[model samples]
Target: MAEIQAKDSGGKGGKPKAKKHSTKIDMTPMVDLGFLLLTFFVMTTTLAKPQTMEINMPVKAKDQEEQSQLKASNALTILMGENNKVFWYAGLPDAPAAPGVQVTDYSANGIRKVLLARRSNKDLMVLIKPMEKGTYKNMVDILDEMNITGIGKYAIIDVDPRDEELVKKVQ
Candidate 1:
């Protein structure tokens, strides 16, 4: 609703006064229309879908002996520690000729280099061991690296006691 009113200035010295008009605008329709547009946009707009990484786990073997046989040369172990520390070894840490555990970060030149070096091995399997002090971010970072490097076979296993000792020694 809108209205206009005229106000008369009082006559002074026997002179006629002029009238001034003032307009008032009602914004109720505008306010209601604004709310309707907001509601329409909110109801019709689509929200982003959550992004998730897909991991394919191996099927269990009936025989324990068959399941226990993992090639040492084809295995790579990555250990996540506190403060975003990363340590990796070419093969099993406790193998007969145990490989030395080397420390690396989560940068393109660090773990990525190591992963790329062995990417040619078709049977390469990466084993991720998150230590007690490691954060969830560390785990996610390594998993992302696995995806980035196109590593098909990988597992998130618990850190062994000997692996923990090795990590401590390197730290």
Candidate 2:
């Protein structure tokens, strides 16, 4: 019968011991990977431009009394249809005829004129009441124009007073 003998330690009076198991993980590679992912997200993620004015949207109300009070002074009511057409009405609603009442192709020129004229008074306000199917791009464009024209005073309104549900949903 063959007999197996254990290897002796270099100096100690004991058998050779197994190597100690390593539990340490290299964090450098993982940290590099995390930084790379963070950089990629920072490069690719789109940051939306913030709104200039604080819009106070009216709550869903059945009565017209609440709706009537929403129309304040220096309000510029802009009507946008599903077809991308923009119509603007300037000044108080009680005014028989809005001097700038016209359905025109969406452009900054017309908006600029109205806004500049209104900007004469620091307390002037402009209200935009777009339709339900109005594109967000259109709204953003209008907002951009307003910001560019230095008309910081404005509010968003519901074009259709009957559709309180839609207004609430959009708001």
True-vs-predicted CA distance for residue 171, candidate 2, Å: 27
Those runs of model 2 whose alpha carbons end farther than 4 Å from true positions after fitting are: 1-73, 94-100, 160-171
Collision pairs in model 1: none
- For candidate 1, write residues 57-160 as lDDT tens digits: 77887876776567899999999999888999999877999679999999999999999999999999898999999998988899999999988888889899
lDDT (CA) for every model shown? 0.90, 0.64
- Alpha-carbon deviation at 5 in model 1, angstroms: 4.0
* Best model number under TM-score: 1
Over 4 Å off in model 1, which ranges?
Answer: 6-22, 56-68
Q: Each prediction's TM-score against the native? A: 0.79, 0.47
Candidate 2 minimal-lDDT segment of 10 residues:
162-171
Clashing pairs in 2: 76-127
Q: Give one digit per residue, the lDDT tens place, for model 2 in 9-43.
A: 35565765664443555678788999999999999
